[model samples]
Target: MASEFISSDIVSILLFMSPGFLTIALVGKLYGIAIEMEQFEKTVWSLIASIPIGIMFVYLNEINSIDSFLNCFLVHPLRSTFEIIVFSLILALLVSLIIQHKYLENLSMKLIHNKDDGFQTDRTVWDRFMQKNIGKAAIVETHNSVYKGWLSANSSRKEKREIVLDSPVIVYVHENGNTEDFPYGKQIILFGEDIKSITILEED
Candidate 1:
């Protein structure tokens, strides 16, 4: 059954149109998810698998004399089959983006700013967040102080219990808890025990 399906015209058209087949690769690149060779593979495979699943949505054509006319018209490069393949893959990509990016991103406050965690399985999920956000703005609050700075640390879960901060700025909070930045510090090493909480700030 699998071999028969693989030999079908649907798969043939998809394979023949290989040049523009995975437009979802471009989409993932736009979203910054298709970086490096490993992630590129993931993005392409996700879309490749998605294309056939997407075809299920297209509703198979009914048998009739018009089928011959349609087939004749589709013999050229820009065939009706190509159109079906492209549009179905795109719709599937959209749904895939929602599920993999938006839904999973916010599912457990798992990523910074509730955004999709980009291509990285380098460490634990939270650790991966820090790895990707290096050299970006961050706000760290400890037991005795608040800080804002460009994150200079490259921390992984394997490191166990510390995060390094470089070029840190002190943030002073008033009685009502409104904070003002008083940028200060050369470098600070924060032990996990001392950290009350840390927020990776927005990058402009």
Candidate 2:
């Protein structure tokens, strides 16, 4: 009787542990996909953030069914499967939400604030630069200026292109700031370190 009781307790512990483990694994997988798609190099960081939350969920569930928890393992395999599926779905949703929020936060910083230009919210400067130069390519005349060029960043040779501003570059210009024209015979480059503000100028 003693041996049987010990075996049953062990089985119950395994059953309880299984659901949580499944939840973590499923969430982790979804997070991994999000990381790849978003190119966010913080998988380990996200996983670390989630651990405490997972533990809290497990503790809460255990507290609700302290007595017959172990018996849940032996009820039926289908029931166990169903429970795990539901838990995994919830975990996936949570992870996706976390990932999305982080992505938006990072994206927000890349936006330029130019309220006087009639933009209500901060707009991504790099995106606007691209839009402005869509038909006529703009060359980085200097760290602070862009000029019309025959070849835009898209068509330029890798060697001729500025490594910085690889993504859309956001420019922030102060209200009533001076807009400078792109000088001739100079390449434009917005080094990651040199970005102070973004300004849109009308061609004179």
Candidate 3:
């Protein structure tokens, strides 16, 4: 009897704890966060986060007349699970936005009379600078070539950073120190490994 009860409890936990786990996983992926938690820690955190979601589910169900249809066996489990999954996804997206943009965090800090504008982000200095300055005209230099273009996209990773330039021009330097620019009418991708320097031109 006790064994059967234990098995049922385990099944219930596994079935109902998906929202919390899904939320955490989605948040990490969306915001590019590295989550390193033990199984026990994951379980505890999932349980904690799942509580509010579960309460919201119950409140919505109570307010709506869908409970009558949800009581049916075919509709109850599957539809309820789908609704919870959707709610979890929305919550994860909102959480990711809050963390990535730091809108809520900065507002809270200001409300609390903190001096800093916002919390320190978990991104590299290059990533932070480029994110704000992308779409600006810049000069990128490599071992063999120099490119002038508008910055299009930049990778956020610390290693093997890559960037794309729109409407690039290749600047060739002769041995006599004279420079010539040849317009390359398409986008060009440059790898961080070969890049020597990048200079962002000031706005006119």
TM-score of each: 0.39, 0.34, 0.55
Which stretches of model 2 miss by more than 4 angstroms?
33-67, 103-204
Better of 1 and 3 by TM-score: 3
lDDT of each: 0.61, 0.48, 0.79
Clashes of each: 1, 7, 0
Q: Write the per-residue lDDT of candidate 2 for residues 40-146, one digit (tens) a residue.
A: 42444444544544355446446355335554444555754675567556866675677667975555444434355554553344555654555343334446544
* Candidate 1: stretches off by over 4 Å: 1-21, 37-44, 47-49, 52-76, 81-89, 92-101, 108-122, 125-164, 167-204
Candidate 2 vs 3: which has more lDDT: 3
Q: Residue 180 lDDT in model 3?
A: 91
* Top candidate by TM-score: 3
Best by lDDT: 3
> What's the CA error at residue 2 for candidate 3, in Å?
6.4
| Model 2 lDDT at residue 66 | 34
Pairs with steric clashes in candidate 1: 169-184
lDDT of 3 by residue, 75-130 (tens): 47777788888988888898888887989767754554442655554467677668
Residue-level lDDT of model 1, residues 1-204, one tens digit each, is 867654565555554334233544555554556434466665576557555533532344332333332444346436545655666456546646775667856654464444465633444765766767877777888899988777777556566667777888788879998978775768888787788877877656
